[model samples]
Target chain A: MTVPALSVQGLTTHFFTRAGVVKAVDGVSFDLAQGEIMGLVGESGSGKTVTGFSLLGLVDPPGRIVEGSIKLNGTELTTLSGSALRARRGREISMIFQDPIATLNPLLTIGQQMQLAIAAHERLGKRAALARCTELLTQVGIPSAEARLRAYPHEFSGGMRQRVAIAIALLHRPAVLVADEPTTALDVSIQAQILLQMRELAAETGTAMIWISHDLAVVSSLATKLAVMYAGKIVEQGPTAALLRDPRHPYTAGLIASLPAMTTPGTPLTQIRGTTPSLLSLPPGCPFAPRCDKQTEACVQKPAMTLDGPRGWRCFHPVGQTAGAPT
Target chain B: MLGFIIQRFIQAVGVMAVMSVIVFFGVYAIGNPIDIVIPPDATQEIRLEAIRRLGLDRPLYEQYFTFLANLLQGDLGRSFVYNMPVLELIGGRLPATLELVLISVISATVLGVSLGIYAGYRPDSWVSKTIMAVSVLGFSVPSFWVGLILILFFAVHLGWLPAGGRGDTVMIWGVAWSFPTLNGLSHIALPAVNLALFKLAMMIRLARAGTREIMLTDTIKFARAAGLSEATILRRHLLKLISIPIITVFGLELGSTLAFAVVTETIFSWPGVGKLIIDSIAVLDRPVMVAYLILVAFLFVTINFVIDLVFALIDPRVRDGASA
Candidate 1:
């Protein structure tokens, strides 16, 4: 079989704070074929963002990838460090962040910043670099791409800045692109536009993506596959259509049920009970057991991930198994 | 941008106007220079002549207006001690101070910012701790005492440099410069280091604080994610981010040091404006005192204006704010 674009298995990242070891991302595993989009879904603090950072080896001090195997196009990345890892980052696997305003350097113009990114890996002539920057900007739907390159981050509106950030991320058109809530800070109209553009770009470039977000409607609209994370672990994952139609994990079911589209107008939307367990002091066995409506004696002991072809979940009593149980 | 510059220039003129008033009245309050200018044994006629000739015999308001009128005419009156124009007297001594203060502040900024960035980048390292410790010592030690110690260590003990005074001079563009000759460089060294000590500490602290904050920003993270090396990130991204505050302190320190590097100057006996001002004070030279104080105010206003422009140049946000 052809190698997948990105493969991650048993990835465990932890923050070694003074309080304790906080497992930010624990045992996350997924694979994305070329040009595929995998939506990493979770609430805040669910390790989705950390997972994305782990993929790029971008976790700062006090937090690090303590254990993991992140392979990009069958080349192991966890073993790479320092310059080796840095070389691979933007050239092979790039990432765009959540807030465009905060991500781009305020002091630098878009042209200068894009040029710097280009210069980091290859030595391109000045004319070629400018031409490449313009092409990427135009591709990303930035109007007057040539003139816009001279504009600073503050000069661009929120959406425009994010578009610039995306253009930078796609400069080399790496095999894997990990976007962390890139469109969340944008308006709905802009968000839809970016999402559609991103899908087209991924298809054209054959770049796989792990789109991390908490917004189910936004994710479901774009992602081909879905992975639901709760308390630093993936509880359910499968094709987007199959998972949404039949959420095997109770937490995933709750997330699907809470979406505005899933509920009648004016009715109270369903929400998962309780906040995520603190990573510093997680409950033994299943971390989400405290909030699970189908919690049983078996939940006291963590259930192994049960798989059916491409679909898999870690639940003792999955949704359909508990028919007539509390929704 | 032109409007902003014009507005700043008007504000600078307003500042100079207020500074002139304060200096004129303040010098007037320091007792009539005639008492010190004329000998006590001088006859009443001689005393009267001296007072009239010096413009001290006029009413305080008239004397202030005379000073302002003379200032507008580019004549800061004649120095009673030197019998030369006050501006000419100051201009003769200013180059010495300018060269010394420039060397000290520029070297301090370059060295301090580099060390500070390194310290901030690796705060837990022993080198950072040592740098911090040295900065604290720099802040706490008085400049006069530091000046003496510097003399003792470099001049007396090591015998590697001169103890005091501008040793030799070479004329450049009709100005006596001590920097050209090795002997002059040796002479200026101790005094410059002594003047730079406190400012170095300040720059280090400012840069360290700025770097520590900016290092954690998403801007740095994004740069790193773009595969920019740590050195590039620090130089290109961190430096620009931290430069506004550092440049502000640099301008302030440069002005303050140029205006009031008295303790170090006195210790080294370097013939700069600081010495000139002290000597003028002793002789109750009103013209020199008034002119010097006004010049100090003008220097500060000009430096601050330049710094604002620099802030605009480095940061588009500041540029927008200024034009708006």
Candidate 2:
């Protein structure tokens, strides 16, 4: 269907470590239709950012995409050469880093930084490139962007810098934007503002987004579809409302329950016991079985994703009786 | 910024003050001038009178004040050995020394930085390995030794240029704009090259290290992912990050070049402050000796300040902070 704006199938990324080969992304798969926002939600080390970095070919040595078909608009990105991948990045498929401070070059003025990104993908002269830089900055809701162009990264407050970074990423109007924890480092108020700006921009540009975060609330607010990952696999995924309304994986229930809410204050918050297992020593059965509250004998040998109803789940006895209002 | 400048100037003064003390004592520390002037047997009263007239009988502090006053007034006192104004003696030799140091600094900075960027960009490659090999060679060999070897092979043996002296005596100021000598440059050239060789190695090594560090930065990796060309990456991103360390090392190298000029000047028989100080000290020409010592100290401080400015220009953080 319209080649899905982005399609990932049987995607796996592994890291060869002294301990062992860690399967960080064990055959995780998903799709994002054009203009769709896909929320890839997980706690730390769930391979969410890794997956995003992989899509843009940002994974460095030691960690590699061993098996995967990452296609954007039907053009395969996984197999692209280094130069070709770079050309696509920030131009056709850009990334907004979790800590924008780390993402931006501190030495250059915003204008120079934006011009560099624009020049990397476009054939325009510096004068034209600067004009477009101001336009993008203005589009991202940065006031007085023309004057701000001369200001370096350090001068801009944290939220402002992230906006400038976002402006730079959108300078060439990429089709896909991968935002990795774009709000995690910001103050709550600033985070809300930046997120709002991003949502508006996504709508205005019709950019397909892979929003990666541990905060399901934030994701649910922005993404129509959601994938919950544990250890290194997507244990459950479906339409955001359906998954939130009736999460089918015990771990998914634990995550949703753990989220702060008005209704759950009196109900002792549910927590998935134990940490996500180390990838090197992942249980032979389901990676989350050691921590899954609904584990059984069938969980000892890993339950493969079974198509049940409208979503996918990797549980022998899938979670039943979704959250209901006792009307 | 005013505070920084004032502080730096105070530090410079302190250095000059110490250098003056050492110059004053050490320059006059040797045996009395009478021994060399009159066969060591001049009548005691005559020698005493000579000393008194020359103000040698004054207390050390008084003599120091006199020397300071003379220096402030641009009269570097008198060179007892040269029998001329101390300022004139240094003035005569200053150009030769400046020329040598300029050539050496330029050579080391260009060669060292180029080699460093290349080695860093191609670590473990044959080109990098070759550069490392050459750097090791350049580092271990002493500059004087390098000079000797150059003289032996290129000058004495090959006879391409004059073996010594600022060219033949005939060419000395024969033309208003002409330099020390045609033959003399062959000698000066080797010595200058020798002086710069160590700095070349240092620059390359430091540059390579800094470049490698810069290369590891996420922004650089991001730049690479964004499809920047290798040339653009190296020139715009790589070089800027390494400028601070390179400038730092280069400043130190420049200071050492001033210090080492004495040795190089002696080797080539070029009349620079290095040789001027030595010749003054040999016969206890205290004024010229003090002048040259203070001059070298001044050169070191001034060069370091300029290097700081260069570093600030390269790193915006520093520049903004300093300006702020």
Candidate 3:
């Protein structure tokens, strides 16, 4: 097997709130190899986003990695201090925020903002940083990067601003890029353009990527491997093609069926029946059992992720034709 | 830009006209100058003669036009109290006040901004907390109260410095080779500090809010991700974000500072326009009061104009709005 570029072992994050402790990402684990795009697919409360944040140590106050081991190229990240982790961030890894508007400062000129970006890690002269900023802006397909440099955030359209943000993330050329739904906020056409550019950039840079999204359609098109998360745990993991063609877990099967498939054009789309279990008060047994069609009475005892044949899944009983059922 | 300026000029003229009318009627319509200066026992004839002397008995419109015409010629009527040309009296006191105001604003901006940046970057630290607490106390307590506190402890109790005044007239100017300039500066420092600390509190609170909000943005996080040193981000990002708000507050505050200077100038016995305006108020020297008010109003209007111009220069979006 190819050595994984990143391995998240027994990764867990919990939050203490007024209600109770939230197991946002409970014992989640996955691996990504070099130059491979891993899709982390889940619903809003499934902890997919939280898992990505944990890998980067970007979880804000009150939410923390309670138990986990994140090894980025075999180096433990959980032990890194704030300064050390910051050093690792742009040099080795970068994350794209969900909202482009909330990301760029409204008051600053794009050139000045980009200058800070380049000068942050390198001790280059002002002119050199400016030159690099122009290069990166141009690389991200901004029209007239030179003229656009002097423009403020409000001056640009939403698509253009997101492009600028993408340039900022790519300027340092980090080894691993975590895009938490980068194109989720854009219009359909702009979304396609941005995703195409992102895919091209990833291939060119040969960077390992974790594309976190709720829409299976977007990730299935871009990622080489797919990991389906239920509640706070990974319910299934396999090659993207295999998972899409033959999902091993009932939850994953439900997810595939829910998509608006061309093969069943007139038929009503399949969507998971029940709500995701709350991390704060998860039901004993499989978190997805309440929503699972093939769950058994034994599912109430709780099931741990177990390997089924060649894939991994966390289900007490599979969908008969599927493998990797949790036991 | 030229069009924006012309628009502002028109607005300034209208505002000044309205303000002048209020000053004229607010002071004149309240009571007779004769009743104020002479006894209530005085006869109507005496009051009428007093009113005629002050040019209050003329047709209201004629009086206004004559006042406006004289204003065009820089001739405000003679002060009833000072018994001198209103313009000339202002000229005499103006330099002292101008000097005090310039000193206060300069000192306040430097001290306030430096402290504000420090307080903003480390909100949770003791340095930030202490500054925040001090800022609250500084804002709530009156400027004059702080002035009294300084004079009591430093000038009276400690005897570490001279109490007040610009200086003995002999030492006012002339050749200062040694610490003479230093001594003059030392004399101004107490009152200047008194003026500055309160304004400092205001700027600090403003900066803290601006910085906190800026810090939350993606750009700040992106900059940090670049592994750029904290100092670099502060110098480049934090300060730049701060300039827009600081410049805005500075412009408006610059205008009001002239008005506030009166209070500070009076407390420390520092000679400035503020003190001159106050003296003119005590005697109902209407013309002098009117001239000073107009002079102050003029300064405010010009400062605002310049501020808008700067906003246009730094940001193009403002340019469009200013024209519109």
Highest lDDT: which candidate? 1
- Tens digits of per-residue lDDT, candidate 2, B1-324, equal 676667778988898888888877776776566456444777888888878877889997899899888877877787666678877777776666767787888888998899899998778689999999999998898777787787788877988765455654332443211145565455567777877888888888998888877877767766664566678878877777778777777788777666557777787776666787777667766666677777777878888778877766667777778767
Best by DockQ: 1
Clashing pairs in 3: A120-B228, A258-A270, A285-A302, A315-A326, B97-B272, B97-B273, B262-B274
Runs with alpha carbons beyond 4 Å of true place in candidate 2: A17-20, A262-269, A300-302, A308-310, A321-327, B1-41, B122-126, B129-142, B145-189, B264-271
User: How much does candidate 2 score in TM-score?
Assistant: 0.88
**A89-166, model 3: which lDDT tens digit per residue?**
766777777788877877678887777667666778878887888888888889899989988888888889889988
How do the residues A1-327 of candidate 2 rate in per-residue lDDT, one tens digit apiece? Answer: 367888899889988877789888889888888677888999899888788878887775578999989988889988888777777887788878777777677777888777777778778987788789889889988899899999888888889878887787777788888888888889989988877777788888988888899999888988888999887789998999999998888888888878878244677766767987777888888888788666677777777887756588877767785432212
Off by over 4 Å in 1: A322-327
Chain B TM-score against the true chain B, each candidate: 0.98, 0.88, 0.88
How many residue pairs clash in each candidate at the backbone level? 0, 1, 7
DockQ metric, candidate 1: 0.85
lDDT of each: 0.91, 0.79, 0.79
Better of 1 and 2 by DockQ: 1
**Each candidate's DockQ score against the native complex?**
0.85, 0.48, 0.45
lDDT of 3 by residue, B14-128 (tens): 9999988887777677555565666689898888888887788798778878899998887887888878898777776665665556677766777777788788777778999
Fnat of candidates, each listed: 0.82, 0.44, 0.51
